[model samples]
Target: MQPFMNSPENYHILESLDSLVQSISENQKEFFQKVSEIRDNHYTLVKSYYEESRRLIEMLKETAFLCSLMFNIQDEKSICASAINILRKLLENPVAIRILSTSNSHTKLEILAEESSAAFSIKSLCTKSPLSCIAIKTCRPIIHSPLESAVPCPEMMESPEQYAHICFPLIADGVAFGCINILFEHDTDIMLLKRNIDLINILAGYVSLAIHNNRLIKTVKKEALTDKLTGLPNRRFGMEALQNEINRSKRYGHVFSIAMVDIDHFKLVNDNHGHTEGDKVLTLMADLARKCLRNVDLVARFGGEEFLIILPETDIDKACVVVERFCRIFNEASLSDVLNAKNLTLSGGIAQFPHDGGDVLSLLKAADERLYLAKNSGRNRIVAGKLN
Candidate 1:
């Protein structure tokens, strides 16, 4: 203070410079450490999330494909198997799967898909916080958790073991008709879960759409080829189906029989009672024909008051017996008596595959010849084969 008083400004400047350098060095070290922490966190989060999203997408796609198989058959086995495979793939970390349907008054939970399925595990599947209905679903991008398991499914006490779950719902017409859930052995992050959910929803929506489309296609196809009154393949569908079956029999070296059925004096019933009575008779005849055949047989409304039967693996004799029994059952069911419409009777013409003729047109022509003979000979009886 005494000596530097003459040049105090210079001394002060030197001291301030030293202090500034120290402060900068300390800040740099702290910043570098922070950068390292952020880098590590980003790596884990990005990599895991990416892998999980990819896996979920793949599983969902596979599930969609599997569900598509339902269009092929009326049985439950194939459809259920396809659903299981989808859940097993999507929820590898989960203990099981539980499907819930919301199309009715009560929420019906169906175990459509599962892997290592628990005898009882409710905690992993549902909770009040994110009720099955409240759960989010998407046909678009998902950036958040779609379902919550925080409240724990109220049905948990009815189950066994610890479980967590994610849900995929099938929505149509603004209604959530069905849901698919993944049961996990542990809890998960809300954010990551939201992403997983998005993937699942995309899958669910696609599958639901496909199923709906296929169902509609089936209904339309049935209607197009079927006679609504008789529940038989309509003329349009009958021809194509017969042609296809004819080819199948020849290619496979299997015997088949074709029969054309007509109501004997059907026009008289229409004229006497009304068309209503005639329609009833037609329906009854189809029902009787259906009851007489094996699972592989096909029946079609060949035309007005006319029906045809395709019997795979059957010869002319067997076809004749089948038709005869069908007629007997018709008499037993007694539709005309029950409805009080008209007492009905029928005449039929039968032909064996290959033996009767080589093709659909040829076989049909031969059967028509027999039918003509039967009608002229006197009605109410069967005309089978070449009549030889």
Candidate 2:
């Protein structure tokens, strides 16, 4: 070992050892730096994942609550009120609902229901043209944030810059019939709405479905209570109206009147005019009765050729005025063309609550008796009581 250390090769071996140590030191520093960077990245990823999971769970909870709220409500107004409440809770702002109605085959946009806290009218925000609403036109949601430099939609521009507007088109089965409009009183954070946008969308869908189902229910109920041939309320509905009037009169100590009207010799007309013409006469009578009666009055088809008329807050004398007016109108209307006779006329009998009878059957029986008297005495007149 001493002999080797004395040679020049010893110096070269020491230099090589020193170079190897320096290279190892440099590589160790780089490896530790890379490890530190990887640790930080993993923490960031974990934090991001946690945040996302929390948001997803919150969204699921909100969706479940909304579905539960919309489940049992059958009234359209009640459904809208529930929807507005949930949206207000979420955004801490006022909400409004607008629905589409078709009349005479024309679609009309109207505000069906809204919250009282709403600062602006739903009609004011919506223009006459449905296309003006961006959400409705595109069948998508429009989010106007305080952070945005420019408001994209004109409807959103109607609100002050300090207020954030969110509009979600209520679409179901590819039909955009309505929208849920929220006007945030404060400058809402864009992320709050963005994070819950899907929740809002699901809410909109539930609203549309609920409203559609409600309308179907109402239509079915209306059809059930209405007569198909004469387009008037049927006997069952007439009885209901009479009972309601009786209850209201009894509660308030007021008086109401009911009139039993019968077409003169309706059986003879049907036998002679072949039922088709008889139907025409019935329709004509309904139209004429509607013209003669006031808005508060209810005229329903009682049976074959008879109609029941309810007059609220009226006495026998006032009810006679109404019955007489109806008789005049019936006489003046052209009935000869359908019946081939000039004798077609109307006979009516009037009865008042608490005066004629207390209950529905008693009042109906009294009215029927008077109606029989009118028919026996004269076919074209009204009977209020025992003929004098």
Candidate 3:
């Protein structure tokens, strides 16, 4: 049997066994290659998912920050400032915010806030040709590189050639109210901006809503404190302002003055002329008073045909001078334009702080008493002191 195994006929069987072993070895090698390839593919998929998830998480945090801005900030400038800060952090680039307001069919761009890490001054890009801003004209997001276009935006010509620029129009209720301008320092930064477009858009939306809410709040507050007919501060605001002035005077030992003003024969104007004309008279008086008084003075409509003026850092003589000047201007105004009557005159009584009284009630009472004396003695002159 051992001799037969070594013979030429038996050698063919050994060759067949060897061939089978070689075929199995090749199949095992191919199988291992497929398994290794599949493992590599799985690892790539997991890494992609992880990166996407991390990006989403960061976006959520950023969105939450913008949402907080809506509730916390009330001033428009402050809101823009906060938005610019957060945007600079998220984009890792310089940022500027501008608001466009439409008035009389003309658009104006105001640069509200800016944040930059670079050592260059960032100014309003649309100062010369606001209408030429393509982003505002199209109401779309604009990604611009000076090197890529033949004719760049007119406003963008002054920007550095090394930096890329982006503009995101802030639209609310289908109207573009403002834009967020970003400066990309490098090509990689531009790529980053492209990848994070959706996130930046969401940020723009939040900022738009914040500005809208702030304007609404300011309008409501103005309407509440303002007199509708004369466009002056109403009685409630007047009293609050008086109290505030009193507090300031007491704290700083500063001398101030208050005056009670009355429109002379205002009822006769209403009775002779129509109430519409009377409204014009009130408006005229308000305009004249505002024009004559300094910016630090407060002229409020205390009641019908009555005004309370608070003059800060003014004594009795200066207060009297202010009222006398206002009276001159008020009397010289053309009343015949709106009404068939003579010129109007104003009677005012002035009182100094610490000389009259310390509190709002006492000061008001003293001024009112002097005003009554002015009305009884004659109706055209201002009285600064009580009768002896």
Candidate 4:
């Protein structure tokens, strides 16, 4: 019984099973190949999406940096510089070449910043530039072909032969502060400019806010340092100025002088007359001191009836001469008619750098001591020199 080994039925069954196994193996291989192709395609798509997202994020970061540059700065000139820098960055496009700027309520448009091969005479933009005028008037952004339009700006006329122009208004709170003009080659993709329109608008808003905030800060700072009644620097500002002078003198090894001045019989005047007259006297003293001192000198109201004057590059002797000259003029002046008093006089004490004292506190103390000495010795005299 070599048995059924040679049976045709068994052989046929074995052949059928072999065929089925081969078929299953081929189908499995094809399924794995299809899965691999799908995986590759998915990876490619993910990579593309990630790269695009990264690029967009970088652009947004750049925009944020530009806005920060505009907002963080507090000076008009610095703001202008920032705006120019942004223009330079935006102009990095091969198509963009020039920029112009103008302010609201201004008749002339100026070439703020530009980068081009040709010399541009576009110094001013006339009202005839319909694009810029419309943008400013509407407080909006406009895109147009400058070459075809009636853009009477000399700069635009001189601009590259074929170009597109974009004008954006810097507006905040319903007020247009300024406008920015940009130039691009005619062949530049309009879609690209359209894509950046929102970003440009955001930058304009930041610029407007920066200018407004800078002005407000300047006004506040001036008010902080100034005396309301005398129109002189207040004590706080005087102290800061004195410290600065000290630092400067130390650095340059130069001599400077400071004086503490007091009005003679100020209390008596305040008592006899009303406070209104007292205020007037103070104001007059400030004006007189301002007139007497050189432009390099600084005068500040230290306290009631007391003023501090900082004289740069002056010695004790020169300070004494200056104070004496001022006193003589003040005493001889027709102040009686204004004050309802026969005479109005001033007393001052001088302190020189490194001679009287080295630091602000020491110098102020020394000057104040001499001022007391002058008051004790005589009401209307100046005391200067090293302490005895």
Task: State each model's CA lDDT, in order.
Answer: 0.66, 0.79, 0.80, 0.76
Model 3 residue 334 distance off true place after TM-score fit, in angstroms: 4.3
Clashing residue pairs in candidate 2 are none
> Mind giving the per-residue lDDT tens digits that candidate 4 earns over 1-388?
5557588888899899999999999999999999999999999999988986786677668977877877677767678667666756644453443333453436555544444435333334333343446676777787766445545334345555676777777666786645677766677776667766777777777777777788788889989999999999999999999999999999999999999989898888878987888898888778888897789999999999999999999998998998888787777662567666547888889999988889989999999999999999887999996678
Total residue pair clashes for candidate 1 = 7
lDDT of 2: 0.79
RMSD of each: 6.3, 4.1, 3.3, 9.5
Residue range 1-388, candidate 2, lDDT tens digits: 5787677898789888899999999999999999999999999999999998887788669866776778689877788878777766555444443443322232544666666453555456653445567788899988876768746577556656566677788776687776777766455667767887888787788888888787778899999999999899999999999999999999999999999999898888778878887888899889887877999999999999999999999999999999888888777774456445455789989999989999999999989989999888877889996544
Q: Candidate 2: lDDT of 240?
A: 93
Cα deviation at 76, candidate 4, in Å, is 3.6
Off by over 4 Å in 4: 1-57, 92-118, 126-136, 147-165, 172-174, 183-192, 329-342
Q: Rank the candidates by lDDT, best first.
A: 3, 2, 4, 1
Candidate that would win on lDDT: 3
TM-score of 3: 0.87
Best by TM-score: 3
Instruction: Give per-candidate clash totals.
Output: 7, 0, 0, 1
Q: Which residue runs of candidate 2 sit more than 4 Å off their true CA positions?
A: 1-37, 92-108, 114-123, 131-167, 172-174, 181-192, 335-343
Alpha-carbon lDDT of model 1: 0.66
